[model samples]
Target: MPTTSPFALLLDVDGPIASPVTRDVAPEIIGLLLDLAVSGIPVVFNTGRSDDFIKQQVMAPMIAAGMPSTLKIHAICEKGATWFTFDSTGAGEVQVDHDLAVPGHYSDEIRELVASSFASHMFFDETKRAMVSVEQNIDADNTEYRRVQADFDAAALEAMIRLGLGVERLEVSLPDANSGIEYRVDPTIISTDIESVALGKDLGARRALNLLSADGIVPGAWFTVGDSRTDYAMADWLAAHGHEVSHVDVRPGDGIPAGKPYPVLTAGDLGLGDEVIHDHAGLAFLRHWRAQLDPGMVINSTELSEASV
Candidate 1:
């Protein structure tokens, strides 16, 4: 058996591992992940996706790629509300933390608001176990889509406040390319997820650690990769705990800084940057890490010399 690495790679399913446009994992990416796991590197998929999606989109492909039975795959899903592990065989039974579910009454009201105000532009996702989500068919240049999403963001905040969650309205933003100084209000144009304020990627990272620790495995170094701005919260949390963190921002220009708490590198900075592409970056990152584990493996080129190990 190969010796496991002290490091673990925590990934967000969408964007970094799966393409945001097609919502599919590339065959090469799946094969690389399987190879990494077999090489004794722990891989955790943490995302806003549901267990069913994880099974169909991630685990299923990995099993087909010959994921070893000895390899254990951990996942934190629906942001931080669901947790589970899968072996080489099939999808594991999921364990959901219902405590993180949005209040029933609040969910009902939010559902009505979306149905009444934004039904045409958005649709409720029933697959969500702990949160209420309305997904918008996003087109970056579409003015109408942006307007409807902003309207939903405002209405959702008002609903949460009226329910006395005591949480302030959260707005996702991005730095404008032309003027790096200006930050634009960019709601998750693809999906707006409303759940308990206690649940987030940061909490998910901790949850993943707790689960792994239960198995007597404590990670030495941690790396997190995601395509969205909110995903930074995970790396930030890990870094705050004094762990060396390597953060890969597949989308880039999310207005977050690199270094200090952890070092942040963009997909483009890693030699796979493309305006609307993502899978290439995912492939490059996995290959880079795999090379680190195998001394015999030679990397043709990379810019992660300054990244936190």
Candidate 2:
């Protein structure tokens, strides 16, 4: 294996960091994150959650749960539409870099098309940069969620086709059929300005990664963990840039993209698959990677105690 030390961990909040809805992070997984922090690995939270939402919902809970205070942690939020850095000097201060958030120069026609076709379902939110959040009426209990998703998917597919934005991508996903479903359109489609809205999200993630690299963060040495189609672009970007990508899902096969050659760590069908982070097989892999950082650091023996079971 290629040896690299002090690897940066890019974690996806919903899948690897915390469970959905209940907002509970497993004890063992917390231990693992704590261990990584204690061992001096830099971990960055990369997610679709907004900056304010991540701090309040994810980071705050982790810190309260005895996570290491000295760890060098960073965050890329809003589906890579924003980047924030937390350092020893700043302490609780979060510095935002907006250049990464702006969807590179896009044509006006794409915006008009999105506005006309999905007027009721889509609207622009002015958080970091103007991003269009497409709301889909989905029924989680009934079969309507899937139907709604298909409609949204068809709209995005058709938009992309009409605009001819290759290289620029749009990501359509079922956020949480239980709570609600939302998708994002990109800002820059090649052929038609109308398709740019579908490409906004895909463009944002790519821009964020580019910004990270431009700021001296190497992609090949970085690791990203996530779940869902919105995260697929980031995964694909990392893998293409020679970075290691891991997908963490509560259920092994649930919602994960098919035919991606990356490794996936599952917490089982429900949340029972926590062993993927707590057990020997999982810990061993983490330790092996951490070992490249500091040879003296050791994997906790207790982690693998249940291996025979």
Candidate 2, position 64, lDDT: 63
Predicted structure 1: lDDT: 0.74
* Model 1, TM vs. native: 0.83
**Per-candidate local distance difference test:** 0.74, 0.47
Q: Could you tally the backbone clashes for each prediction?
A: 0, 15
Residues 1-309 of candidate 1 have per-residue lDDT tens digits of 233357889999877887666678888789889888787677898898888888889999998888777778989998889988998888778898977787778778877887887887777777888878877653433456667787888777666545544443454422233323111112564777776667779988998878777777767788898888789888988988887888887777556664546677765565543552355676778878788778998766443322211
Q: Which stretches of candidate 2 lie over 4 Å from their true place?
A: 1-7, 24-28, 66-69, 87-223, 244-309
Winning model by lDDT: 1
For candidate 2, write residues 81-114 as lDDT tens digits.
5556644333355444444332333323334644
My TM-score estimates for the predictions, one after another, are 0.83, 0.52
- The candidate maximizing TM-score is 1
